[model samples]
Target chain A: MSRIPNAFAKGTAFIGFVTGGDPSPAQSEAYILSMIKAGADLIEIGIPFSDPIAEGPVIQEANLRALAAGTTVDTLFALVRSLRRTTDVPLVFLSYLNPVLHYGYERFFATCQEAGIDGIIIPDLPFDEKDELQAIAAAHDVDLISLIAPTSANRIANIARDATGFIYLVSSLGVTGVRSEITTDLESIVRVIRSATDVPVAVGFGIHSPEQAHAVAKLADGVIVGSAIVKQIAADPAGASNKLYEYVREMKAALGA
Target chain B: MMADKKRGRFGDFGGQYIPETLMNELLDLEVSYNHYRQDAAFNAELKELLDNYAGRPSLLYYAARMTADLGGAKVYLKREDLNHTGSHKINNVLGQTLLAKKRGKTRVIAETGAGQHGVAAATAAALLGMECEVFMGKEDTERQVLNVYRMELLGARVNAVTSGTQTLKDAVNEAMREWVSRVDDTHYVLGSVMGPHPFPTMVRDFQAVISAEAREQLLEREGTLPAAVIACVGGGSNAIGMFYNFIGDKNVRLVGCEAAGRGINTSQHAATIAKGELGVFHGMKSYFCQDEYGQIAPVYSLSAGLDYPGIGPEHAYLHQTGRAEYYPVTDDEAVAGFEYLAQTEGIIAAIESAHAIAYAQKLVPTLSAKQCVVICLSGRGDKDVAAIARYRGRNVHE
Candidate 1:
């Protein structure tokens, strides 16, 4: 496996997610730059899928908005290629399997390599089906990040054993949405994941506020905030940059302390 | 056509392409299905319910009048329309609901298109004393108001989905989203032979009783197999059921009629097999109406039940392997077929099932007199009368 530089090595990495082309590609690019400027150690750009079953209403709407804006895989690759000229914040793609399949797996990974994308996280592809895409992803030096869920009690170690770049620790049992409480016994899950691999585990799903991020950061190597950032972009597309910057700054601060 | 348990595949189609949050639940469900599928007690209970409750062993009525009118092939109709709840949907819901109870799940949720599956699920939940909820498109709830009311009367809550095209596909997306959160206590009774893994395989097995019964009845009456077996395809549940038992009978040509809303060439159609690309949606890798961007397009059909963007993975497999032939039937032809069956055979069929009859009308005319065609009359037309009346510009209420 060609090892791409790991962003989780940065202390308490604060990752921000935004659906590409939410509002417009230009505006979304600006939003991402601002989040990075505000202290997001890593950036996750969601390639919009028609049906995002793992997401709640907030991210679902964002996907609808992006697709309506005529966003496509080629468009996102072009946008990321432009972003590569400017930033070095470890870039990852979040999308469903169909787009990747339709785009052609080998071409998709080769494009990601050219676009300077370090990883891909397909929510629909579980650990069992990772082998379908893992070989190609590794060949392109693009990590096919694994997600460890609370319900993945026995399968955590198996998933973590082959996990590259980082392991995404799902802090809750449901789809991606803001929640007041994450009831999963994350500590025990994390212990199992840690025992299997030296890869950093970045907790995600349902983590919204600074307090939630801070609470999760204490147990994991990093914290990922998705719907919360996508919500800001959707709530005020015109002024998303400033709002997202402030929100990411606060969440980053929580991760630090 | 049994799918492999580990791969969950019908050839290159049908796999568990879902989020990790729901992986354990699907795996757990697979284990439960494997264990109970062979259990004699489980089979006995399900068989008893199917026989007494859903009215299993639906008649294989030889349509003498239709046969005489066609002047070619002998015609027989598998009367799934005569089943309780007026459709074959009860067969699957009964099987899944019974399994849910076995797993100690106290609640069940499902997605519906034309409201037939919703009504069936509501009936099963009420019978079993389990909480039930169904997600239906807002457009469909209004169109199939009678079925919605029937579901409510049967003690199931119905959620009107307004997302995407506000049709069957969107309802499935909403139900799947809801399922992830309540995976522990609730079982998702997927309506069609679609979705992730066990759902496609399991639902087909339950509905396969249709063909299993038909095969024996046909042999008893005709002393041989029919020349062809036909059913409508949306997510392809009824079609798969009708074809499963007859797959090995190579001479029995398995035909699936897809809804060509306006025409296959036009933007308005749900003919996935005729005009679709291989893509994953709602968990299964199948043929979908997708654009160059890989986004599933909003599909249209006069029949709400056939207004789905994708077909079941097994249907895709069948079509690909040349084991099944799919034809497109326009709305105009389907309406004519609906009225023709009513006049010729004195049977009014669901708009979804009429698509198959429409195609059979064309095919039977070309076949030899000794040949026979068996049509899966998937549901009755009571739920579709109002909609059909509106489409034909006549108000039955008037």
Candidate 2:
């Protein structure tokens, strides 16, 4: 029943991410619709947290902007409900565990199902600690995405085998940001993940530029971009929708989708 | 012994709630720590550093003047202020840096609030010949300027973090980010019993030497255990160390004093246990001062060391089980205690430790003279003289 599988049913999937309620809830909804219109296969909406340790300066600043705009969990759920009326794109949430825990697991996931959210990616909740919310997420028909980094050498196969929706492969060793050059051997890491499961592998973190997306699409099933889109929104909040549409379109075309 | 029922848990608290990039490194650190904790040679080397370099077996001095002034319980002060780095932070820093050396780590990084832990880490790194870097809040660097110079003189790079609520918590966030960037030849020498897994346990074990020595010292001097033991709690390293050996003693009370900047009722306070809720941040599930939306609140305190938003997980477990008692001590009362100790015993204790002294001032008068109490004097107050003078409206330059 999850729409995550359909995202990768085509050739390579183009996943675009933006922090929900960034600038404003209305603007965020408009931006997400823009990406969807520009051929984004799946969309990841970040629920702004107070301290996002996993994020870099770009997304951290965006979280502050969203929070400063008086965005809350209830407002974001309303935003999603509005989006579902027009679009059937596979939507996911990127959040830290605290906000989800504060919202109560049962209520948060049930609301996710009602709002038409297909999956979630929690950067702070590693595979060892996923047992706290794994069952509850599965009971609600939501896929709990798992991440594998370059440091996750032996843990790659074990985590990939049990991952649902898709596997988020970190392109480098640091926090989320744009990098001039990613020198990590992602092809070898993707090979280990491919050997362990049939799930789609999507690379994110430090990914930007069409050339980088095109190169990554060759080895993985999807190419995910976050900070690059967030930077566009930060530069000009009111005009971000058009910029986001063009950026997502360029990245998706580079994926050869 | 309060062994964790789960691998990294203390009751329903304490888990490795971190990114995947750091999980393998934490697991490896746990394995290396477990191996070295029991190895006799490693223990002997650490013992040498603690005894010769850091000055262990700190005295349990009978505070005759303070006892007569209070006119109630007999008082003893555990003199951790006399240690080489002027605080109890040296105890854990020596152990961690030595362990990092044994594990073949070439560099060490840490986060500090009052700059006590930063100085301690730099000293240990210098002694062990490892590269050292410390992250401190930009606000803290202004308040504790001299300590910043101390860390620099000891050969460590001090990074002024300017993130959210630029304080101890932000420093921790920046340190974790830096560690994620380079975990191969680096070791994050966590300063307190607050971080993920091995840190809370390992730091506590290293600091448990406080109560281990004090218990025997009390027995040798008083011929019996004290009625209560008291220490201030920030990230709660010293308090946990002071309370660890006494946890099995049902009759001995374990007390912790928290920093209430203005008062617990006001928004300007760092009293986590008094006003915080349960949430996960900074790699642990514990009581944190946060908003209804789970955003970490900016906490305030006169003492930089205790200006943290969350408490250690073990402290959270201890509070849940009602094994220990915690109280909020306002900055005014702590300043009174600071002056009281300096005038009575001629010992100026750290403001963070003065919180415990403030609570003792209230509790001692209610107890009978036959009973006794011991307070952990966790650090020296030399670094606080300028700040304290400024707070009293005297604006003395450092």
Candidate 3:
């Protein structure tokens, strides 16, 4: 073990998203910067593709807008190059493995590391099929974060024991979307995951507001607010710098940061 | 390639269009298949099961009275209908079941059309104490009664798929979606030589034993291979098997007949070979009858077993290659053939097999008088009587 200390230090961290080249390449960098100022400890920049199987309608629609705006590998790398100027918030590229594989895994890890990316989250690449890819990620010092679900127990342990950074615990069985309330069953899922490894367990998939984040943060080491943050960005797609900062500040306060 | 050999084609069909996730897996499978194809270890395993369990090497009977009446050429029936489960479906099922057990899959998932494949898979799952879940079209669950009972008796939970057209297509969609989620502990025990990549190759290899055994039996009895071989095509397993060994022999003509519920001119038919277009459904790219938008059109067939929207990708590739000639047998002709075999030969043939019998009738007349033709009477008709009787406008009560 590299003795990587406890992740993000309890309630002080929040992860946000910026679709690569959203609206245009310039606007995407602006949105990511605004999110960082609003107290986000990490950033997940999505590389839009034609097919995204694990995504729900919201992200899928957002991706379509980004694709229409002429997002490509060159544009994405340029945007990431721009984001590294101000924030040292551990940035990560989140996507299905296909895009990463297409970008070439070793090259992707190297480029992202060069641009100061922390890790990656690929929803579909299970741990069982990740040895060679994991080795490549390790050689580049990029942690490929593993996702766990409610039904995943024994397998979650396998994932948790092997995964670095933090364990992404999806709060529900369904795809990512806005939900009304967190269920009690999530406690058991968190319990199972916490038992597996000492890595911080971050709960996501439905935390829309600071209240929701605070409730989940009581059990999980971190809370992920995706759809809610994305929804704020959608309201002012061209520019929402103030709204972005305001939303993150509320989430940080709710988490008692 | 020898006589009757498709030279890697099925009659004139079978090709591979797949993703990178499966390429290595398929190559591994092909390596195993090639290494074991002629190996005594593989044959001994297949042979032992066929003899001790499935009661295979089933009889080759001469339907003398029917042959004399139809005239033109002598006819022989390879009795696959006499296999353990009253059908040839068990042969492939047992083989794959053993393969799954060996592969260490804790559970098995399958998609079924007429439910014969479901019953066969469930039987294997029950016998081996492995978990099994079968996806059946909601429409088929209502249509195939005895098969539903048969599968339940074997302890398989049936998922009635409601997506798409709510038939075999939907069942296949649901099963594949489930397989995508549970590929770790589960083996998708494909029913036929259809679906995406490895399945087409794997199912064909397992079922090829049918024609392999039939070839030896034919040689021992007639001193040579039969002049022609015929079988029905659904996902085309029976058709593929009865024709596989003959691929090496050039003189023997192998024919696979598909169902045309009405005339090929009518939309109410499963003549995928004749009328369907190019599209991917249930995995591999095959001939499918579709509308302008590319969604699969509703397929129709008098036989539940034959009512599929797309031909197996291999069969489509074969049709394109011209290694096997594709013919469509109409519902009227198939029904008449079913009764003709039942009343004449005293063996009830499945509605699916009726298509082959219908083709054999037409083929016998076209061939020279002394030519010998073998029709693979693929399944027994006990399960199909109600559907056939209803099609004939008769009440089961009477």
Candidate 4:
């Protein structure tokens, strides 16, 4: 059989987080393309929740802006529904656990499958208490991504064991926010995660600049950029489309992908 | 003697009413419960934990002087009050806490009304080294400050909900909503035989050991089944457990007394069985104190444990099905019963359980002179001793 598409199978991946309806749907398409052009292998689109326990202020503001723009579960569905029309870049939707639970697990997965969402990352929900959801994810074939926190090497080993699609490693101890640098133990996290499985290990939460992404690129299978992109879009929600795209592309170039 | 077999029903009381998100999870729990509930090893493990960890096989105390003072019927107390944490709540908590760990969950969350369940849940969580959060109404936090402090000392976070009515119903809604979101890594330890489907059935099953052991102890002591068994009803766990083993006896009468703070006719009451109408809240369909429009209305009882507006759905079904007769005992009667018990039996009971004592107090005179009665002393009077002392204008410190 022919191999999977080169963009997806590419060794070093670029993951982009664009708040759906940020700037506008038209701008969202533009930002997505710029990231695609700059070697984004997977696109992590966020559908925000009101009580986001795991997110800090940047993404929270982006979610508020998106909510203010009438973006919703339906709107996110519609975005995925529309994106399926043009792109095949693997789509990983970052959402708080409540919206997904409120939407009902099976229906959400069915909707994801219908809208072509490739994976899910719910930061607050850990792995062991996932028996019910695990069945739903398996049934719909929508990957339920896992996060290994900074503290638990043994739990990281276990979470890495239960993970499917790709392992989403949270870069710090706290909620998602901008940080000064990736920690000194960053390489060991990658090594520990890699030891648990051969699945691609993507590091997310704080990488904002090309230099930071490049620094992490030396150690991770992929780098995820969220708060900065959301911050840029929030700064100019109306004129944010092209600027957001350029920012994503510049970060990608600095990572040398 | 499992009242809720097949559909997890206690008579026609329990069944599932969950969103589709939980269908698969509930199904798995049902399968495991059905399988493990009968497995010898499962039963043995649960029994060992109940004995060693929960300090079970509580005692059957002969209320000799109280029996002589009543001067008619013989009364034996099934002392659930003497258990660890000073109540029967530990029995259910230890059971569910262990089960949560077995299911690979790292944390537990629970909602509390009187705070008995919250403290019990916190105790189990601390013992098991699991993360625990107890959701109490902001109003309840103020009312039940001692229990709140007790829960905090157990290393559990006590979340105060200010939304909705700021009571048991509101706390439950918040807890269920939290469980819906965090089901991936947490087990919601429901405090009573309330909520939808499995929980009413699940919690009842855990607490049933109370009545099961009581039945055997009663058989050995009284040489026959008690003429009646009574327990107070809040969300109905203690009552259900006390009556569960007696359900099949056919000759044994089962009674549940709800708190009527003043009278059922007055607004100041938690008499769900007497004054409630058909309504739904916190997952289960049940009898709730509601307006003509069926909107949930505020309910009051001096006892924090009986302040909830709705009775457990299984209790409702048992009432409707005529398996158990329900009554509402007023505050004056309950306080009188509490004082009578402490003076005569030398045992204090939680104010909530005093409702049952008051019911039994009324029943003893009316029963045939030789008849036997076992009133479930569901919890100790220690928690309510301060309030009782205050009610009588006596210095509790003295």
Per-model chain A TM: 0.97, 0.98, 0.92, 0.91
The candidate maximizing DockQ is 2
The CAPRI class of candidate 2 is medium
Indicate the residue-level lDDT of A118 in model 2. 93
Off by over 4 Å in 3: A1-257, B1-43
lDDT of 3 at A167: 76
Query: Which of candidates 2 and 3 is the stronger one according to DockQ?
Result: 2
What TM-scores do the predictions have?
A: 0.98, 0.99, 0.64, 0.61
Q: Which scores better on TM-score, 2 or 3?
A: 2
lDDT of the candidates, in the order given: 0.90, 0.93, 0.74, 0.76
- C-alpha lDDT (0 to 100) for residue A177 of candidate 4: 72
lDDT of 2: 0.93
DockQ for every model comes to 0.63, 0.64, 0.05, 0.03
Error of 3 at B182 (Å): 1.5
lDDT of 2 by residue, B185-282 (tens): 99999999998987999999999999999999999998999899999999999999999999999999999999999999999999999999998888
Predicted candidate 4 versus true structure: per-residue lDDT over B1-398, tens digit per residue: 11224454555444454432343455566566677767787678778878987788989777888788776678888888888887888878887787777778899999987688899999999988999999999998987788899999999999998755688877876786676546668888888888666678778889998899989998897688889888999888899999998999998899999989989988889888899876545555578786543345678887888888888888898899888999999988999999888888788888988899888877887777568888888888766777777788887641
User: Which tens-of-lDDT digit does each residue in B223-316 have in candidate 1?
Assistant: 9899999999999999999999999999999999999999999999999999999998888888999988788888999988889999999999
TM-score of chain B of 2: 0.98
Stretches off by above 4 angstroms in model 1 are A1-6, B1-6, B396-398
Docking class of 4: incorrect
**In TM-score terms, which candidate is top?**
2
